[model samples]
Target: MWFSVAIRVGLAVLVNQKRYQEWTHDKLKRFLENGIMPNLYYAIDFTLDEAVLDVILIQGVVQCPKTMELYTGPTYIPNNVREMTLPGSPSGRARPIMLITTVMRYHLPSDLDWFHQPLTHYDYRKQRATSLAVAHPS
Candidate 1:
């Protein structure tokens, strides 16, 4: 018998909006099931973050937590988007949180500490943080 633990990929979005953005879980579920990519926010050379979300969405299938196919572990996308209804609006947006728990070897991050930081009201501050590290684990 082949004994092995299974791994799976999970995607969860946590949004922080300037104003309350409206979107039901069903809507998001549908989009996710269909691999619909949101207008996520990220600066240049931040493909690591974007890639994690993209791969999970593109795969559009949950992988087991121990599945070898998934080298990257589960990714958790914490609330990041701000101010914008699902239908329209959005000067900017946040990255969709995803988990790749299938492959522990990869360790695809789900909840980076920065995810806890609130969005800045100031344009300059927000701009600077766009590419810089906002949180560090102690």
Candidate 2:
């Protein structure tokens, strides 16, 4: 079976905004000192193995005790627009929460046994509905 896990990254906006501004200002200042406007944006790539993924998943999400539902929402991509939510604390205080999420696609092979059988029909709609129900419980 193929499964997709969503990973969400959280960041504090208001508190970090000043730091970001200062960093940007410093970068711009350096550019000005060099007598040139910086052509912004740089790309970097890194690879991870299964062990790394497992560690991250374990650290990031809170597992549901009864259902064992793994909720790993978005993960931040260095420079990308992300969704923000207001999370309420135990004290009923709300704070801004920024999240960038991505779905991790993987597969689980089934054993060739009587208990494990493939679906007779490939009904994507039915599968999607089931997945949605599982993801969002009433």
TM-score for each predicted model, relative to the true structure: 0.21, 0.14
Model 1 TM-score is: 0.21
Question: Which 10 residues in a row give candidate 2 its minimum summed lDDT?
Answer: 36-45
Model 1 lDDT tens row, 1-138 = 000111113223212222213655565444344332222333211233332333332121122222223212233322232121221122343333232222123332333333444565433325435465568789
- On lDDT, the candidate that comes out on top is 1
User: lDDT (CA) for every model shown?
Assistant: 0.29, 0.25
lDDT per residue as tens, model 2, 64-125: 33344433433222222121122223123211111212124423224322125544432222
Pairs that collide in candidate 2 are: 6-72, 7-73, 7-74, 7-75, 8-73, 8-74, 8-75, 9-74, 74-101
Backbone atom clashes (below 3 Å) for every candidate:
28, 9
Candidate 1 overall lDDT versus native: 0.29
